[model samples]
Target: MTFFYNLWYSNSLQYKLISLMLYPFSLLWIIIDKLKFLMTKPYTSHLKIICVGNINVGGTGKTPISIFIFKILKKMGHNPIFLTSGYKGKISKPCIANNDVILFGDEAIILKNIGPTVVSKNKLEGVKYIENLNSKRKIYDIIVMDDGLQNYSIGKDLCFLTVDRKSLFGNEFCLPSGPLRQSLNSCKKNINKIILTGNRNFKKNHNILKKDILNSYIKVDKVSVKKKYLAFSGLGNNVKFFDTLKSANYNIALTKEFEDHHNYKENEIADLIKLANENNLKLITTEKDIVKIPKKYHLKINCLKMKIEFDKQDLISLKSLLKNKLND
Candidate 1:
């Protein structure tokens, strides 16, 4: 099911009924989570915890955004490390983010460039690893969590809720029935910041439920394309990928978008290369897609670098908030 279309059926009201019947599950889920928060000790000590998460389930570009903040922290001389429930890896302890995208997935590998990073499924275990770090050798002051908006075990001073600009509150249904991880109204109350990825919706009441914390709305555009290219990606919203190219006025000769978190095969790379050569087009893809691709085919590809374009005041507030967090 393509995340958004899973909620309702066209012919019958059956889907809606089923979803309504299961709505209690969302309430139950919310209650259980609140209880978890009430019971779990909020392991907080003035250390800055900035959560970059989303409203819908996939494709908000949290990893790149996290790296962007991490780089800024580095420039300002504050050590930053990335923490994640390390989606998909089986590593036990908070090992240095050393594995390649193929090994530990793209997000963890990407953060390694900025500073120390760890991917543990357990949040407490991951934080423990950070706590026991060598105090003498460049201790980390700020933690940029990639996907912890739902995690209450660790309290964050500021949480940036990232939503794929195209799919904000997909189908507006919670989990199994839709793309939303939780209720939309809950997000408005909990999040410290709302970051919109890609172009603005700009329609009447486009942001009906999210009017409150729309402080940071980031849009990604493609770099100027001086040449014709074959575009493809394994991202959640590949339409946004193609739209970015279109916005840049780049003519795409061919494009093949895969499922989210797709693992590339040697044959897949070869097929794309053959197609690109046949069409006389240069291959371009997103960074997340490039990581899953085999290294042998890397020389043949160039991943589109995503830059977050923000308004002036928003940028100032974000930097100020970050600065204060670091100083604290």
Candidate 2:
């Protein structure tokens, strides 16, 4: 899957041929996506809805950005509840998310730790659930949709599209042909703002205006530089995790990458432990990936905590913008 994902961004002749062959399917996908938006009437809730989403198919740091917004809202004295589709989770109906990775997936569990999070397959159902829950005591003042920009069934008060600076828009084509979930033009029209995440020095190349774009970077917690570590993760962008570790000056002995949201088997974990032990290195991974591992092994592995840090001016503007929107 990673190989194909890389191919999507490749500009080689083979990629061009493959993209051409898949272009028809991409067109069909776009047509169906647009039709869904046209057919469905979005549900509007009294509670303010802020969506953190992306045009790309893979992760664009949506979870972190959503968490950041949730924290901001919390500090501003508003209760914010997360609403997510629980992408790989088994349970389909709307319910409060829990730490069971098999039932709610990693992202849902992570969001649940920060505040109240509802996991639902149908986002509309999730919004309705939040609305009903708030009616009694008004506990949740806002609903933050983790990744639902393409979800046309719920009206959003403010929508933020997260874009990784490293991989802006793979091949600049829609799915099957490239990484984009929707056309860039459609994204600009739907999103209230674009949150660019990654290296702060990365230049802007998209069509969105500079004023509409907010810059942010992942800030990793300090790790012991003396110890050699074996880093691994099953994130949408594993390279980004590895890059973050390198930037933090961690002495990585070896690194391994897995498919996004991979279900780690006991043997896999055992193998990793053996390899790390053999190389005299500590096992380290992202916070999102650590939840799936058995609790017994938790003490053996180190989790790299990360947070999104926005530019100073951008942070001020975002806070003000959010306050104004909530007041409205």
Candidate 3:
């Protein structure tokens, strides 16, 4: 998958040839997706729905941005609940999220830690479940959808399309041809704003101007610069995690990458621990990956906590936007 992802994002002659060969399938995907968008009548919930999603097929900091928005709404005195599909979880019906990563994926558990989270395969069902739960007391004021930009079944009051500044729509082609889930033109039509996450000095290459974009960068907690560590992660963009560690000046002795949302086996974890012990290095991983590991192994591994920090002006703008939506 990583190899294919690299090829999709590549600009070489081989990438061009593969993309040309896959163009027909990509075109079919685009048409089917567009038809779904046009046919569905979105359900308008009484609660405001703020969707944090991405056009890129892989990670673009959507979960982090969603958590950021949830915190902001909490500070503003608005009760916000999270709505997610539970991605790789076992359950199919709508239910309150729990710490069981096996039953409800890592993201659900992460969101549940912040506030109430509803995990449902159907977006509309999730929204309705929230509505029913709030009918008596009106506990939740808004729904912070983790990833549903392409899901048109539930209408959103505010939509944030998160983009990694470092990898802005690689190849600009859809699906098998490129990293994008849909074309930029189609995505822009549904989103309220583009949340650009990455380096502060990154230059813009897309049509979205600075004014229309909300800039953010990952804020990692300070760690010991002298301590040698063996870092590993199973994320959509493992390179980003490695880059973050490098930027933070961590002395990473070794690194391991896995497929996105990989469920670690006991043997795999044991090997990592053995390797770390032999090298006299501490084990480190992203918060998301840490949640998936068994509790007993936590003592042997250290989780790198990360949060999204918006630019000063963008923070102000986000507050104002949320306030206006609440009033409306």
Candidate 4:
């Protein structure tokens, strides 16, 4: 993963050369992806499905945006639930309110705390399980998929492709050669809207973004931590978390990085605590990371809660789009 970490972000000649060598593998990857689409028709769900996903290989603030959209749907008096193909988790079948982070992954655990949540290895099966769960008691109006734009296992009612303004499309190549999961043209054909997950002016960065597609902006919420702290995260883009802290004027004493979807061990936690004590720095991490840790350590660790806010016109447009979907 670290090799990928370097290959995707570094501008060094060596990395570029390696990417070139791996270019053929990327082509194979895209073929396999496309073949799956050709062979299998996506499952159609009865409920409206709003998919907040990305074509980029790493994080582009999908979770925060999903939560933001969920809040809006709830305010509109609709029973919305989160459905995801839970990554890095062991699940024989779809799980509902599955509190075991080790079994369902950290993201699902976090979502369950916020509202009703379901996870499956297959998103189509996940939707099926939700329908069964609803029949027993509670009913949900819509399903908000956390991340599955690339997985065409289920038909999506609405799709929002999240993009990072900075590393828009690394090297503008696909897979092992770059950060894209699929080609930009293929992505354009699939996604309905683009949600840029940073405050950078799209007008200025438009040359890099290039597409004349409909898009909106959402700034990552940077809550001011009152004290100096050490930050750590297992996000696909950990630098963003550290940068957010720095931007919020929070003094970051030390920073720790882990592979995306990293599962913490006792020794690692002990070592981190030891370092924090030695430096007299408070422990801080993203809310996503905190959910993966033991509940016992919750009091000792602080989470940087992420909130997503869109521009006024964009917010209105987003809401109207959802309402229209419901009406349909």
Clashes of 4: 0
**Candidate 4 TM-score over all chains jointly:** 0.91
**Candidate 2, poorest ten consecutive residues by summed lDDT:** 202-211
Clashes per candidate, residues 3 or more apart or on different chains: 0, 0, 0, 0
Error of 4 at 284 (Å): 0.7
Clash list (residue pairs), candidate 2: none
Number of the candidate with higher lDDT, 2 or 4: 2
Instruction: Give the lDDT of residue 261 in candidate 4.
Output: 90
Provide the global lDDT of candidate 1 against the true structure.
0.71
- Model 2 scores a C-alpha lDDT of 0.87
Q: Please tell me which model should have the higher TM-score, number 1 or number 4.
A: 4
Q: Which pairs of residues collide in candidate 1?
A: none
Question: What's the residue-level lDDT of 286 in candidate 4?
Answer: 84
lDDT of each: 0.71, 0.87, 0.87, 0.81
Per-residue lDDT tens digits for candidate 3, residues 19-79, read 8898788888799889999999998888899999998877889999999999989998889
Rank the models by lDDT, top first: 2, 3, 4, 1
| Tens digits of per-residue lDDT for model 1, 1-328 | 4434446322246667667777777777767766776687777844577788876666776776787778878888877779876565556656666766645667676676567888777776677777667455648877788888777778777788776665566557676565677677766777866666665442222565644343334345445566788999877677778877777677786788788778888998999999999888899898777777777888999777766666677777778877886666
Q: Worst ten-residue run, lDDT, model 1?
A: 3-12
Q: Please list the residue runs of candidate 4 whose C-alpha ends up more than 4 Å from where it truly belongs after superposition.
A: 135-138, 199-204, 207-226
The TM-score measured for candidate 2 stands at 0.95
